[model samples]
Target chain A: MKILVIIPAYNEEENIVNTVTTLKEKCPDVDYVIINDCSTDRTEKICEKNGFNYISLPINLGIGGGIQTGYRYAYKNGYDVAVQFDGDGQHNAEYIHDLVKPIEAGEADMVIGSRFIEKKGFQTSSMRRAGIGVLGFVLRICGGGKITDATSGFRATSREVTKFFSANYAQDYPEPESIIAASVSGFKIKEVPVIMNDRTAGVSSISPFKSVYYMIKVTLAILIYRLVGKKWR
Target chain B: MMTDLFRMILLGGVLIYIIVIGVLMKKGKMNLKYSLVWFLTGIVLLICAAFPGIIRSFAKLIGVYSEVNVVFFLGVCFLLIIILSLTSIVSLQSERIRSLTQTQALLEKRVRDLEEKNEVH
Candidate 1:
């Protein structure tokens, strides 16, 4: 339904081509836009070499900014739905359909692919898993866990949501906030079970310290949401 | 009693806010939005503390001297409005920056497309 998949990438020289190529193989008709966020590495050059359609930010705007840019593009180009897939090949291409199913059925405005929904993947370190679990509880309290994956970047949204996010998506660690925002703004949110693979190449952008800060940030943001959210009961 | 409790909390929040904002300014992360809110909040708290009469005076104006409840309620309401207004401003400015960036991107794309069409012609 005029679907656009946005992959926000940084220094994923090893995995960008494979991720883009496989998406082409699996969802040939779907438009995939890779946002190369000022990679000092050859990530942008690789996309150019392969003739992939992409946007290269002049400065590294981070994942949040990159995804927001993608939202703006999808909104301006009149895409009906937008999916965010990681450039690291960690997200499963096959489950993309599942992620978008709720949107297609008109049941949800936002759909996130959860690795922990069924717990079907190589979960990261104990601390990180604990962090995610804590976030899940906080999200649950915020009326956020109707869907399993609160932080999964692998998600799709209907045009209503795409337009909304195109206008205002969070600029950093946005998944949780966006979920809360969508829910509060009266957009139905849901989740699909998907398996996340280990990154086939490159390092994760989030370090342990950042994950800790991220957990705290999302938790506080959720608290703020509960205090002043539209759906606060 | 309720009025006193609310006064204590309000004053404490303002004091902490000033200190935290002072630290932010020291770190060079203080923006106009932040400083403005901080300044206004500081002024409100200082005025309330320095001139405790105003709170009671407002109560008197409303025809209630012993009705200290109104004073506390007014303070809470005032603080809440300030916080909400500050957040709205920050959100609005962020939206502006995003729109400008997107416009710049589209213009760059148009120029590239025009150059390509010229080459083809």
Candidate 2:
């Protein structure tokens, strides 16, 4: 099965080389592309220096838009599956095959690399954990599925979902909301246990100060999607 | 008939607003889609100034206590609607920009690949 790993990056110059090298070593069979979300730093220079396959956006489209760009490319290129691997060095490239296996087997339309299924390795901060728990509960009730890691960015999608996401995707705070959207639209989602590492370089865009706001916004987005999301036949 | 001073002032104000919108449109400072709304608003204001009795009767019909109150209420509502429309416009513009950026990047990559193939040839 043809697979594409989509690395959505913004201002991640420090970690970009390590992340790409790790992917090259670990997931050589999988074709990968980096969507540089108009990083102000030297990320584009690094990508060019490495001769990595990358797309440097003229404007910063944020994470959601960057990932969607990858989806669009995957859809156009006729990739059977597209996996979102974070560029912040938190997500492991080694788990890419595991994330894509369910989709490859036709057992699921999407597979999420979940940290909480086995509850091993860098579970994030306590406050964020609580927020994720709350989101999990809400998704279960509204989306009619048990998502252990609603906010996990390490996920894979089949061609059907890749095309769908290319057309319409949630913007800011997209991870949790996207799950709800997929569920409501009658897509099967599965989570696999995967260990994640702490980001070795660069501060996260979502600061501790914004965690509360993030929680509130993502929760509201999920709920709103439940109301407005269209069900597929 | 309303007082001459009030009528003249309202007429002049509405005329000035229309002129400003026209100038903005001519200067390409405003999108036609958005300027249409403001143009309609200016026309409505002009109509109201031309015939205060229309507003008065409409106010009485709507059970507004005073004609002036109806005018103020209508003004506030128009402003709110304009703000809402502006937000919608902004959202659409951002969406378009995102699509353009993604398409541009994809095309650039394709061009680079083709150039590399040509060099090899």
Q: In candidate 2, what are the lDDT values of residues B65-100, reduced to their tens digit?
A: 777777677778888889999999889989999899
Clash count for each candidate, listed in order shown: 0, 0
lDDT tens per residue, model 1, A1-233: 88999999999999998999899999887898888887999998898788787887775667777898888888888888999999999997888788777888888888888888788896667787777778778888887756556777899988888888776677778888888888878788887788899888788878877887788888898788777866422
Q: Estimate candidate 1's alpha-carbon lDDT, on a 0 to 1 scale.
A: 0.79
What pairs collide in candidate 1? none
Give model 1's TM-score versus the native structure. Answer: 0.72
Alpha-carbon deviation at A13 in model 2, angstroms: 1.8
C-alpha positional error of residue A198 in candidate 2 after TM-score superposition, expressed in Å: 0.7
Candidate 2's displacement at residue A116, Å, is 0.6
Tell me the lDDT of model 1 at A81.
90
DockQ for the candidates, in order: 0.17, 0.81
Task: Chain A only: list TM-scores of all candidates.
Answer: 0.94, 0.98
Superposition error at A105 for model 1 (Å) = 1.6
lDDT of 2 by residue, A14-47 (tens): 9999999999999889999999999999999999
Per-residue C-alpha lDDT of model 1 across residues B2-116, encoded as one tens digit per residue: 3667667767876887888888888989876558755775776656754667766776788765634664565577678777887898888776766676566555655765776
Candidate 2 chain B: worst-modelled 10 consecutive residues by lDDT: B1-10
